[model samples]
Target: MSEQDLAGKVAVVTGGGRGIGRSIALYLARAGADVALCSRSNGEIEAVGEEVRALGRRALAMAVDVAEWEPVESFARAVVAEFGRIDILVNNAGGGFEVTPLAESTPQGWREAVEINLFGTYHMIRACLDDIPAGGKIINITSGMGLEPRPGNSSYSAAKAGAHMLTRCLSLEIWDRGIDVNDIIPGLVATTNVDWAKDRSSVESVLAEFEGKSPPFAPSERVKHPDELGELVLWVASMPAGGPTGQSFSLARRPF
Candidate 1:
């Protein structure tokens, strides 16, 4: 698709204040889609909104917690009110609160993980379903942890696995409406947020460790940049109707 192929389309991205979500919002704007972004960080989302507007596309930024249905529903409504319709929904608001073995993981930690990752995705999709027209696209940003087991990431992995399954189930349920749902499993993407990288003293240090480690299966493994992931998201959103659905695309160094 051309750079402006998404012209006249509207998209909503959760956790769009920073990281991969921020990149996705900017890329979608670059592709000519008006974007609505939300996150708990008001300053970040507002700054991203400015960046989107700089791209000559309409933009809306709101402070929201996707884990909470009320805020998500409000966000959806606000987007529709501002843009008139929704064409793309990227569920990217999630994090691993505590990476510990299942036995050591607290009930609250597991609940938070699942609610933020899986339930948040569900709430956003449900809240925006009516606004999204036929042929709309839903992209769930999952993780390699969901596809392959990791020793200390049980809670996070379980939540992401649930999200992966939700993508397939929702794809089938919404098939008649012409909406396509898919999951993206990104592995070791380089971003500002790297709480898990305790070994690295800085972001650059973390990235350096993965330098020249691009996996054969992915475009790059040397710590995939956020924009690279945005490119993949744009490709999926630009697919022709009935092209592909209920599929999981993984961009990771290790095999799943």
Candidate 2:
């Protein structure tokens, strides 16, 4: 597809303040789409919005906690008020605690994980469902652990897995309405979200260990860069009407 495919379009990206979300927002802006960036942090969202404006596209940055329905709804209203329409939705905000043994996991930890990864995504999708017109796109950012069991990170893995299934169900329900829903199961990506020094001395030391665990045959043969995933998001969102939908795309090589 060409960059102009998204020209004059409007997209809302939750967690668009930094990391993969930031890249996706910028890519959409570069593709000529007016973008609304939402995150819990106003400073980061505003910064990315500035970048979007630099790309010559209309940008709105709002502080939104996607887990809360009110903020999510307010953000949607704000975007519509400014841009007059919503053409795409990227459910990208997510959070998780460090891996802990299932036996030791607390109810609070599991609840937070479910709230952020699953409920947050649901709120965004639901709030924008009617806003996105026919032929619109919805991309849910999932994780590789969502596909298979993540022994230590059980709460996060379970929530993301449910989210992946949620994407498929939404696609089926909305197919006749021309709203396409799909998901991206990104492998480990280098992001500030990572707790690099939980046990290691520094980020550099942690990164060395991470690099050693990298999968072969993967694009770049290492953990993905945030912008690399962003490029894929742009492609999926801009794909022609007949392009793939209701699919789970993995960014890493399949172990089997």
Q: Model 2 over residues 168-256: C-alpha lDDT tens digits?
A: 88988988878888998767677777653243453344456666565332434465668888888998888766567799777766541
C-alpha TM-scores of all predictions: 0.92, 0.90
Off by over 4 Å in 2: 1-4, 196-221
How many backbone clashes can be found in candidate 1? 1
Question: Which residue pairs come into collision in candidate 2?
Answer: none
TM-score for model 1? 0.92
The candidate that wins on TM-score is 1
Q: Local error of candidate 2 at 243, Å?
A: 2.4
| Poorest 10 consecutive residues by lDDT, candidate 1 | 213-222
- CA-lDDT, candidates in order: 0.87, 0.83
